[model samples]
Target chain A: AQTVTQSQPEMSVQEAETVTLSCTYDTSESDYYLFWYKQPPSRQMILVIRQEAYKQQNATENRFSVNFQKAAKSFSLKISDSQLGDAAMYFCAYRSGSNYKLTFGKGTLLTVNP
Target chain B: GAGVSQSPSNKVTEKGKDVELRCDPISGHTALYWYRQSLGQGLEFLIYFQGNSAPDKSGLPSDRFSAERTGGSVSTLTIQRTQQEDSAVYLCASSLRPSGPTEAFFGQGTRLTVV
Candidate 1:
């Protein structure tokens, strides 16, 4: 079984600043995928970014990027030029190669201050 | 619909009653998933259906929780003899494919309250 852990329960970032949310997972499989999802007050889950375990280069999607360290089993999400709209509950997820099910962390509530 | 849509955005039922929550995935999507979100438990995966194949129900917490997808489109999650513990937000997601790394579009979710 794979487990994703987000140590921080809540985080705050000033507008125009950058913030990073830490995530770690336990998986024996050599191939897998890591993801970050955002859920606002509307309770709609949205995909933020994704990183393939086989890729050595980190994945970047505009202001959202991931620091994926496969050896350390760590995948962290970084948000740059943070805005008030970025305030939401961020979750780290893991999916093994053989399974389509995603294992998610408890989530970190992000509060972007103006 | 442009995205996954769930029916009865909110459901309130008495304990020991039965309830059914419906999910309509995006057209042409081959994969559908059901998850439960509770204040304390966070988000928990419940079941997944890929096309017409047998669903993976490994995450179902109890036998009272069951789900089915017909024609590989709409799905229904049924809870028999609902208990207070079953109160939570039920979310549904759909993906174009069942492979890993694919993005999933989610519904607003059905908030179930068992009093």
Candidate 2:
């Protein structure tokens, strides 16, 4: 069984600053995918970024990027130029390449303060 | 209709009563998933359906919880004799494919409250 862990329960970042949320997972499979999802107060979960284990280069989307260290089993999300809209519960998820089910972390509530 | 749709945005039922939650995935999606999110917790996988393949119910917490997808389109999650602990937000997501690099679109989710 694969499990994702987000050590931080809550995080705060000043407007226009950067924030990094830590995530780690336990998986024996070499082929897998990691994702960061944002769930706002509206209860809608939105995909932030995705990283393939086979890719050495980290994935970057707009201001969101991931620091994926496959050997360390670590996948952290970095948000640059943080805005108020970035305030939400961020979840780190893992999915086996052979399977479609997703395992998610407890989530870190991000508060972007102006 | 453009995205995953979950019925009864909010449901409040008495303990021991039976409740049903519906999910309408995006058209043409081959994969659908159900997840439960308790307050202050992460999303918990409940069930998954991929095309005509047998659904994966491994994540179901108890036998009291069951789900079905009809015609590989709509899905319903039923809870018999619902307990107070069953109160949580039920989320549904669908992706074009079950494998490879794909993105799953999610619904707003149904907030179930068993009192």
Candidate 3:
């Protein structure tokens, strides 16, 4: 079974600043995918960005990017120019290339302060 | 539908009663999943259905929880003798493929309150 861990329970960043949420996973499979999902107070889960294990280059989506370290088994999300809309619960998820089941971390609550 | 659709955005039921939650996956999606998001917790995988293969119910917490997908499109998660602990947001997601490079689209979810 693969497991994802987000050590930080909460994180805060000033408006227009940058914030990084840490994530790590345990997986024996070499082929897999990592994702960052944001769940706002409305309880809608939105995909932030995704990284493929085989791809060495990190994935970027607008202000959201990921630091995917396959060798170290770490995948972290970085949000630049943080805005109030970034305030939400961020979750790190893992899905093996062989399976459709997605394993998620406990989540890190991000607060973008003005 | 344009996206994954779930019915009964909010449901309130008395304890020990049964409740059914429905999910309508996007057209042509071959995989559908059910997840539970408890208060202050991450999403917990409940069940999975891929194409015509047998559904995966390993993640189900107990016998009281069961789910089924009909016609490889719509899914229903049924909770029998619901408990207060079962009160949480139930989320549904669908993907074009069972695995690999495909992204899963999520529904708004149904918030079930077992009071």
The top-ranked prediction according to lDDT is 2
Off by over 4 Å in 2: none
Query: Model 2 over residues A1-114: C-alpha lDDT tens digits?
Result: 999999999999999999999999999999999999999999999999999999999999999999999899999999999999999999999999998988899999999999
The 10 consecutive residues of candidate 3 chain B with the worst lDDT sum are B97-106
Of models 1 and 3, which has the larger TM-score? Answer: 1
Candidate achieving higher lDDT, 1 or 3? 1
lDDT (0-100) at residue A38 of candidate 1? 97
Better of 2 and 3 by DockQ: 2
Question: Compared with the true structure, what per-residue lDDT tens digits does model 2 show for residues B1-115?
Answer: 8989999899999999999999999999999999999998899999999999999999899999999999999999999999999999999999999976698899999999999
List the candidate numbers ranked by lDDT, top first.
Answer: 2, 1, 3
Please write out the lDDT profile of model 3 over residues B21-43, one tens digit for every residue.
99999999999999999987889
For candidate 2, give the docking quality class from DockQ: high
DockQ of each: 0.79, 0.83, 0.76
Q: How high is the lDDT of residue A47 in model 3?
A: 89
User: Which portions of model 3 miss their true places by more than 4 Å?
Assistant: none
Question: TM-score of the candidate numbered 1?
Answer: 0.98
lDDT (Cα, 0-100) at B47 in candidate 2: 94
Clashes of each: 0, 0, 0
Overlapping backbone residue pairs in candidate 2 total 0
Interface RMSD of each: 1.1, 0.8, 1.0
